[model samples]
Every structure is written in C-alpha cells, then in structure tokens.
Target: MGAFTRPFFIGFRRINTYSLHSMRQFVLFIVLITGLVTGKSAYAQWEFYGAGGVRYATTEEIDTNGKPLVKEHGFLPGLEFKANYRRGDWLVTLGGEIYGGNLVYDGQTQSGTTFSTDTRTRQFRMTTEVGRYVSDAVLLLAGTEWDYWKRDILGRGTTLGMEEEYNSWRFLAGAQTRVLQASWSDIYLTGLLVVSSPEHLEVNFDNQVFDQANLSTKAAIGARFALEVRPKAYSNVSVESDFEWMRIGRSGDAILSKGGSPVGTVAQPEHVRKAIGIKIKYRF
Candidate 1:
C-alpha cells in the first residue's frame, strides 16, 4: 500500500510541473504581442507648421441685369498655422489663416454713376482634412472649410461708409502626389475640387433709415491647386504656392428692414473670387 501511494503522489507532481511550463509559455506569448502593439502605436506623431505670405485676391460682382456692379482687387498679407497627425496610413490635418488689408474698389451704380474707393478688407478661413496614403508617393484627401470675409467701404465726401460681410462653407475632395524627387529637394502637386453651399451675405448701409439686409446665395463649384517644394537638408521647411477660384450664384430678394418695418427688397448679385498666394512654412 505504501509503494502504490508514493507512485500516485509522484504522478501528480509531474502533471503539475507540465501545467506550469505550458502556462509560462502562454504568458510569454501574450507579453510579446502586447509589446508589438504598443510599439506600433508609438509610431504615431504630430507635426505643426507656421507660415506667412502675400495673397493677391480679386472679386467681381454683377447685377441681375448682367451689368457689372463692383470689382475689388488687392494684395493682402496673411499668416497661417497648421497641425497634422499621422498614424500608419492615415493622416489628419487642421489649419487656419487670416488676411487683412486695404483693397481698391471700383463700382458703377444703376444710374451709370461710376466711383472708386479704398475698401478695408479682412478674411478668415478654417479647414480640417483627413487623408489616406494609397502609395508611397500618393495621398487621397477629403476636407471641409469655413470662410468669413468683410469689407468696409470708406466714405468719400458726402457719402456714408457701408459694411458688407460674407460667410461661406465648402466641402472638398483632393489628391496629392510627389511629382519630382531629387537628392536635394522634392516637389509635390495637389489638386482639389470644391463645392460651396449655404452662403450668406449681409449689408449695412450706415444710414438710420435703411439699416441692413441679409441674403442667402445659391451653391457653387470651385477648384484649388497647389505646388510645394521641400529641401532634404531642411526637412522642416517648405515653400508652397497655391491658386483658388470660386463663384457664388445670385441670391433671392430679401426685405431690407428699418426698425421693425420692411423698407425695401435687396438681393446679392452673382460674384466670383480668385486668389493666388505663396508662402514659406516651418514645420516641427
């Protein structure tokens, strides 16, 4: 009886040892998998950029009769900042810009009266985008943007100053690709198709009797193009040039209000804007 009991205890000990060894191997496998996942996640990084540049912008508005009403053109100084986060094949970007300056305004009233003035202009823009890398050199992008613009027409002699404000939203789809690769520098090109909608315009007459008017415009399609160059020695610096064009359709007539009473009807005419800009950017 003692021999049989001793052999039974020995068998139990051997089985316990085998179970411990297998459990250790399983724990080791789990640790290795967790480390690999953590290492892959650690590869995600953020990049920031700041830029200053000059933009040349031009805008033209036509009346309902297809007669030109006003044209404004100027060179505006601007500053922009951007941030990007990249993880594996996905990228996210956010950016904003502001531009302000005095512009030359030429206008002709319905009575064939022509006048010119210096208009104080300011523009603000915000953008967000998501991109996916399809290849080493190509990326596809989708984005949305918000834009605000204001113009203050300075009074000339007896005329009173007037103020105009515009708000617009846009959705965009784009593609970017590396066009040239060299030892010192690389060049990239991008093109975007944009759709603008839910645009609003407000006009203040600066008169006690007339007050203000608000109008909503039709949607439009636009496009943007950009070219960028980066130097290998200065990986954190780049130069970019871009062009954009957009048109806003005519708005339905709206009632102009004075106090609590309706004074008259006002409508925003069709307008087109074009801009070209260049900037040097520093990234970190």
Candidate 2:
C-alpha cells in the first residue's frame, strides 16, 4: 500500500484497453455458465476468487554499445482473478492477472560512468484449463495460456527512450494435489510445465525499429501452493496465503534495424519470476 498501489490500480484499469471486446465476451461467458450451474443444482460447485500479491523478476544483464551494459531487476505488484467450475470429476478453470512495476536498470558507460533508470513495465496473462480429478485429492489438467508485456524506458539526456512489447503463448499441463484437509482449512500444491512460443516481439526506440527475426520455442516451469482457512459453515469467505515460482526462457531475438536495413542483433537475458502474498477469497 505505497507507490505500488498506483500501478496495481493502473493495471486493472488498463485491462479493457488490452483485450476490449474479447474480455467482455469472456466475462459474459463465465456469467452464463455460473447462472446455468446455479439453476441446475443446489449443490453446485463453483468458485470465484481474487488475489493481490507482490512479485519479483530475476536480474538480467544486457550488452549495449561501446562495451557499456545494463542490469535490470523488476519488482511488481499484481492482482489476479480466478473462476472454477466442477461437475462430477470434470473441472474447468479460467483465470487472468495483471502486473505492473518499475524495472530498475543500472547502466555503465564505456568511460566508467554509471547511472540508473527506472523503466515502467506492465504485463497481463490469461489462462484456461480443463481437468479431471484422478482421486479425491489429486487433479490433472491441461491448458493454454497467453501473455502480453510492455516496457517503457525513460529518455535520459541525448539517449532516446524506447517502448518494447511482446505477445506470447504457451501450452501447459499440470497437476494439483491436496496436501492437507481439515474441517475448516485446506492446503493445495500444484506444479506445471509449459512449452512457450513468442507470437510477436518488437521495440520502438524513439521511432527506430527492432523486431524479432528468428525466435526459438522454450520451456517454462512453474509451481504454486495455497493454504486456506474458512471461518464459518455455509460461508464462502476464506483467507489464504499463496506462494508461486516460475522460470521462463530467453527473450528471443531482437534484430536491430536502421533505415529499413538489418544492422545487428541484440541478446536478451533469461528470467525467473516469483510471487508470495496473502489474499482473501469467497467461493460461490
């Protein structure tokens, strides 16, 4: 509840601009599904929850001109919403999240001059999954995930600012296991593996352009766990603490361009992202 709150609000506000009509349709679809389920059964299995968390991206080092370089680290504040529906042994899950942060980049010039710039970063992800319970406490799922990222670098002196954007997709498979269950509390652990591909990646350096040339598919690995406590019977209210970790692959190719000609290529560093926080949820 400091400077990060500003970006948290900004991220949610920008969601419509990011997906527009698609998001509206998605929300309506979920509403319709919820209505149908409630109308059909009194013991309906449906859950809607929202969470807020803090996240950190691993440090990265990148090269620049004249033996100069930069190292970046990102601290993000995030919010997420998830919906789940279960009938018999089959379950469907839909979720989305937004993260916004300032990426601190420390740079060193060839002449040994050092400086830092705070680059703004905004990211969003959507996920859908279909799963079946293999046992009372174990579930296996497969899903598709999509991510969008944007970064803005502030100009310093004669250096022109840059805006970078990326769209990515992943096919994922995962399993969830309940580690502990009590009358009023529960614990769950989940692990996932994904094959990720970049749909688009580009950089606009004050109008000069750099685009992805030949991108490579990469693997992403993730895990998350949650502990929840319910306060009363027949009540959907609960408080939970969630922990998650993800290791993502490289940032793909960035082909430098000048006057409509390819000049050089840029190398990007890999990323490891992690988040942990407490959230309150209500199941319906």
Candidate 3:
C-alpha cells in the first residue's frame, strides 16, 4: 500500500459534481493533498518533503443573470509540507502553507464602490488531515483548517504589507489518482471539495473611531491536475491547477436601520465569485 490511505468522506469539498473553480475552496484541497502524501504515524516513514513553484490565478465576476462579469489574473508562489506516521496502509498527517497571486481585475464595479485603495489578491493556510490506502494508485484524504482566508488589496502597488484580515474554518476532502509512474515522470489527477464559514473581519481605518465589520461565509467546489518530474537526484518539480466556484453571504444582517438611522447590528454584505489558478513547486 504505499504511504497514505483513503479519506472516508467530506461534504464541504464535494458539494455535487461541480468543478473546483465554481467553489472557491482551493486551499482546503491543498491541505488534503499535503497531509495524505505524508500520512502514517503508523503506515509511513517519518519524512519531510517540500516544493516551491510559480503559477497563474484568475478570478471572474459571475453575473446574477448567469453570465461572466469580468476576468482577472495574478502571478503566484507556492510551497508544500507533510508530517505523518507510518504503520502500513494507514497514516495520520498534518500540514500547511502560505500562497497568493497578484490580483488582476477588469470592471471597477467588481472592486467595490467603497473602494478607496487599490487591492490585490492573496492567501494563507493552516490544516491537518488523515488518510488510508485503498489501492496502490488511489489515495483519499479528509481534514479541516484551523484557519484560512483569501485577502484582497494586500498592499500599495510598491509596498508589501497587508492591512485587513478574514477569519474562517474549512472542511475538506480529496482523491489522488495515479495515471503514470516512470523513473523520470509522475502524473496524477486530483479532485477536491471545500465548505467554509462566511468570513468576518474587523478593519481599522486610519481614524480610530471608524470600526468596520467584515462578516461573511462561503462554500466552494473545485478540482486540480498535478504533474511531477524528477530531473535529478534529491530534487523534484510539481505543477498544479485549481478551479472553483463559490457562494458567499452574511450569517445575519450586519446592521439595523430605523428611520434612516443606524440602529442595531446584524451581519455584513453578500457576494459570489469564481476563480481558477495554475501553480508550480519544487521539492527538496
């Protein structure tokens, strides 16, 4: 049985037959892959593997009328980590990463009417998973993220600092199917599903008096294609693709208004998005 095992099931990730790009839950899928590949406190050998690569990610606006609003692109950097125990075909795992792509947009409306500063897209991830082998060529994983977020308007065009933050949980599941295995090349097909809470965050404007509440939740489904090549000893390269579609909404009305007056508090704004990305990583 190799090192990893099959994850029983996770609904957040596979919300039907939809593609990952339609879900917007790519990071959870990534954690699923990292944990399982290194599973086995009982079934795997204590080992560490990593890789870094560059990729392209695109986000498009989905019209309420069932059309695409705008298309955008970004450049990205990615890394992978694995920690697990080995005992046979069953293994437990833990892993995480930080990744983001430059934000590319078209229509100004998509950027938000309250937009005062230019924002780009970025992401951070932390998670743990478990897997067991059902067959030599197939591996399944199930896990949850302690925290995850997709941030926008990270920094000024030249400075690299983020001012806003979002908080949420992620439930994920995935399957990896080995298509080819050669001394020089390895290829696999990966499928994933992710379900998340609407992310709510606090933004402190330059003035300390204005406190903005950013509360929302989202769910997405997606898939990926992975290609790996071993060109030399002690090194390997991996390229991956991600696609997702998502529905996001506030848990409750953000604020209450009475007679045109700000009264009570409820929730935040609601929106939907679809995105796709391709990335590469080097393993050492």
Per-candidate TM-scores read: 0.82, 0.70, 0.62
lDDT by residue for model 2 (245-273), tens: 65555555556556657776543445545
Candidate 3 C-alpha lDDT tens digits along 191-221: 6677775565533222212234344544433
Model 3: how large is the Cα RMSD against the reference?
12.7
Per-candidate Cα lDDT values, in order, are 0.75, 0.60, 0.49
True-structure RMSD, every candidate? 25.9, 7.1, 12.7
Candidate 1 lDDT over residue span 94-196, tens digit each: 7777788998878754345566777788787778899999998999999999877877776554444566677788999999999999999999999999999
Span of ten consecutive residues with least summed lDDT in model 1: 1-10
Best by lDDT: 1
lDDT of model 3 at residue 279? 53
Q: Regarding lDDT, does 1 or 2 come out ahead?
A: 1
**Candidate 1 lDDT for residue 174:** 93
Once superposed on the true structure, which residue ranges of model 2 sit more than 4 Å away at CA? 1-45, 62-71, 107-113, 207-235, 239-254
Clashes of 3: 53
Better of 2 and 3 by lDDT: 2
Per-prediction tally of clashes = 0, 0, 53
